[model samples]
Target: MMEIVSSTVEIVIGLLVLIGALFSAFSAFGLLRLPDVYLRAHAATKSTTLGVLCVLSGAFFFFWYFDNYISARLLLGILFVFITAPIAGHLNGRAAYRTDVPLWEQSVQDELEPLLKGKKMKYEEKDMME
Candidate 1:
């Protein structure tokens, strides 16, 4: 019974790690092929977050089962990655936009343009006054 349980846990860990690897690979492909920074950020953050989580979870389970240990570092790393990845991506995209990084040539629309235009105009007026 113990052996059976261990084998099952091992199989699950293997699956989790494999899935994580696949997700990371997809993220890399998106980073390479996506047309613009925004899309690349989306792919990098979302998929890489998921992948790292899956891999860490697998490692957590492996250590717990095999070593009878709980790793706080692994748990903290998971939490940190989950919280920071999307935020970093969003900030990078925003910074790119504010710096006038061009969108993909074929991008259909910019939802932020109208929303930011007023702020931009205000800044321009202020600059002119100065």
Candidate 2:
């Protein structure tokens, strides 16, 4: 019975590792095939974050279960990624927009356009009156 249980655990661990690797591969593909900076950033941050998290979770389970030792470093790494990935992504996207990185042609709406336009208009009005 113990042997059977051990085999099952090994199989589960293998599956988790495989799934994480596949997600990471897909994330790479997305980064390559995406059309623009925003889309690429989305792939890198969103999918890569999930992929790394999955891989880390599998590693955590493997060490904790198989080795009978919980790894504080792994746990902390997981927590750090979960907390920081989205914030990093948001800041990158905002920076890209501020730098006037071109959006894809098919992108239909820009929520920032009016605000930017207003700022530009203020400068334009001042220059015209000078």
Candidate 3:
């Protein structure tokens, strides 16, 4: 009975892990399909996030259940990814914009320009602006 239960759990965990990998793969597809850096950022952000969660959750279940060890590191990694991924994505997208990366021509609005217009906040000296 114990062996049967362990096998079942393993199968389920494997499925979840596979799903997570597929989600991550979808992001790669988005990188090709999406136009411009910003749109691609959305795909990169979302798919990678879900993928990380899926893989981590699978690991957590497998270790904590079948192996009989509570998974602290898996939980911690999930927490870190949850906190950092979106922030990194936003930073990357913003950097792309600051460099004047082109947006899709069909885009209806640009919120970043108005945000940038508020004031000339100087992060560096005049020579840096050039």
State every prediction's TM-score relative to the real structure: 0.96, 0.84, 0.78
* lDDT (tens digit, per residue) of candidate 1 on 1-130: 9999989999999999999999999999999999999999999999999999999999999999999999999999999999999999999999999999999999999999999999999999999999
lDDT of each: 0.97, 0.89, 0.89
Give the per-residue lDDT digits (tens) of candidate 2, residues 19-85.
8788889989998999998998898888888888888988998998889999999999999998899
For 39-80, candidate 3 gives per-residue lDDT tens digits of 899998989899989999999998898689988899999999
TM-score of 3: 0.78
Pick by lDDT: 2 or 3, better one: 3
Which model scores highest in TM-score?
A: 1
- Among these predictions, the greatest lDDT belongs to 1
Clashes of 2: 0
